[model samples]
Target: MKKKLKFNRDWCKGCGICVEFCPKNVLELDDELKIYAPRSGDCIFCKMCELRCPDIAIQIIETQEESDEEK
Candidate 1:
């Protein structure tokens, strides 16, 4: 499975809760102080950031990269 982190920029308040709680350091704050994922490749899909975000701005998207028949 492949995982992607989605952030709702309008909902995010730049609280940095997600960035501070990420165990893998997968999130960061840009110059605008909005949250962004810089080391997304390092994400472990732990969902810590998503849970900690007060604004519910972060979400984890899971996708199948390969066909079931190919598995």
Candidate 2:
């Protein structure tokens, strides 16, 4: 299974809690202090960031990649 990460920019308060708590180091803060998923490819869908986010800005959802049969 694949994991997709989404961020609610409007709800985010630029806190680093999500970035600091991500076990896979999949999250980071930009120069402007906004949170971003720079290494999302390394995400393991642990949901640590999502659960720990004070602003409820981070979300992790499981997804299935499109297969040849779906094309």
The CA lDDT of each predicted structure is: 0.80, 0.76
Report the lDDT tens digits of candidate 1 across residue range 1-71: 86778788889899998888888987888888888887877888799998989999888876675421211
Best by lDDT: 1
Q: Largest TM-score belongs to which candidate?
A: 1
TM-score to true structure, per model: 0.83, 0.78
True lDDT of residue 55, candidate 1: 93
Q: Residue 45: error of model 2 in Å?
A: 0.7
Candidate 1 lDDT (Cα, whole model)?
Answer: 0.80
